[model samples]
Target chain A: MAKKLLTTLTLMASMTAGAAFAGGHIEGAIKARQGQMQLYAHYLGILGGMARGNADYDAAAAQAAADNLLAVASLNAGSLWPQGSDMDSAEGTRAKAAIWENFPDVGAKSMALTSAAANMATAAGTDLDALRAAMGDLGGTCGACHKAYRGR
Target chain B: MAKKLLTTLTLMASMTAGAAFAGGHIEGAIKARQGQMQLYAHYLGILGGMARGNADYDAAAAQAAADNLLAVASLNAGSLWPQGSDMDSAEGTRAKAAIWENFPDVGAKSMALTSAAANMATAAGTDLDALRAAMGDLGGTCGACHKAYRGR
Candidate 1:
């Protein structure tokens, strides 16, 4: 009976350890994805500035910025930010519970920003003035997410 | 004598009008540039939010934000904000006499932000972690400008 009890205990321990590993993997992926997202926004500012200033007015730079945004657009955050995932994480990320709580809105907004950015790039080479106008809409998407999801 | 007097009067009147026009143009440009610069900062907050959120892990969004910053950088305020030009303006633009008084530093800082942003865009695609680190430096540029040139 003692041997059987010991065997049961060992199995329980292994299951617990496996669960922890799985949890860590998810968390790590979320952190890495979040980091990438933040960097993406930083570059967007550069694109907006260039378009508004007519700086360099080069197609290459415009295309490069657009390509980067398209990559971001493809990210599927629905599975990434699951419920209870916002609890004290390493990224010092204030991404609140509202992210999961209101997941649909968050996803929709992200998609909207992506669409706006894509449209902006399309206008970058041929019609800079239109691109400039679209930038405001892109900014609005950022603001909406911060208002609804990010914590102080 | 009458003809000479008329020529002298005409020249004096033209000189006075020229001075007034020059002053008006400088003042108007300063105000306009100041407004644009302030908007750039406001947009920075939006971009920062997206960056911090890693909104879409998007390289294009990041580049777009970085590129858009050139508007604030290329704004050559030297001519627009001549020394002592803020005597009567009331846009709350606390642009000190030192803006024109110390134009080179102002130009340098603006250029610095531009360069930093360009470097950031390049880094963003190849080395996102480095791009994340550089964001603080970019923000410093904005704060430095506000502290030195912008008014409350």
Candidate 2:
């Protein structure tokens, strides 16, 4: 019964993502949003690499990457996240249904990322110690959202 | 003789990249800067995808990607483009020696990117036509820089 209910909800949500754009194609939506997520990962990986000493830290480079994160975070994301495009409805997506169920919270999380990125950008160009401190806060913010709202 | 002189200059420039962070590893420097460029590509690709109609346009998404490009472009880049780490020195870099030979021109090109990105951020979310026009300018600015300073 639980599986059946989930299947029905998934179909309904998929419709929401597809129908949001009217003439918009669902596959394109999925690809665009997923691509955005991949961009996030590419930059975050650079920042993390510096903090971990896995890659050398260049203050300018660090600053740029941090600023990029903040810029991405500040975007209005609603259009990219149509109601049904969660992992359930989309292929290659890991977003959970909770993103729609508690969108306000998701928004709060996005804001948190922005705040964290701002902090990181300020410190990233100063010194490694400062960057390391800011990195911790930024990572925590991202992890919190993923833990609460994203799917496995 | 020109080829040999060029090889000598390449080695000398590579040393500059290696020496920038006294204790830093050269391979790490290469990775870090290359990674930064990749992030730039990632964000720019999104903006371009919208402009090209290869992907669905979501105003919010376009704006975010444009903003991301602007932020990345605004960073101090000297550290990333350490004197020696051009295509000649770094294993995976495509940077041209001309970047070091005529750094002022490189700076000029960078400024062009900044200008174009600023315009893009302003128009990307509000008007597709405006975004399209700005996108052309932005792409042209990038091309100008690559043509002068990046290796084929």
User: Best candidate, lDDT-wise?
Assistant: 2
Model 2: per-residue Cα lDDT over A31-112, one tens digit each: 5555445546645766777888977777766766676666555544544566656789777778888877865566566667
Quickly count the clashes in candidate 2.
3
Where is model 1 more than 4 Å wrong at Cα? A1-22, A87-91, B1-152
Residue B151, model 2, lDDT: 86
Candidate 2 — what's its lDDT?
0.65
Per-residue lDDT of candidate 1, residues A1-152 (tens digit)? 23323333343243234332234434543454454454355345446656667344444444545555554444334333433456454354677766655544655677677777777667655656666776788778878887887788
Give the CA lDDT, 0 to 100, for residue A118 in model 1. Answer: 76
Instruction: Tell me the tens digit of each residue's lDDT in model 1 across B1-152.
Output: 23323433443243234432244344444454454454355334334545576343445434444544543344333323433455344344476655544545665666667666666656554545655776788788878877887655
Name the top TM-score candidate: 2
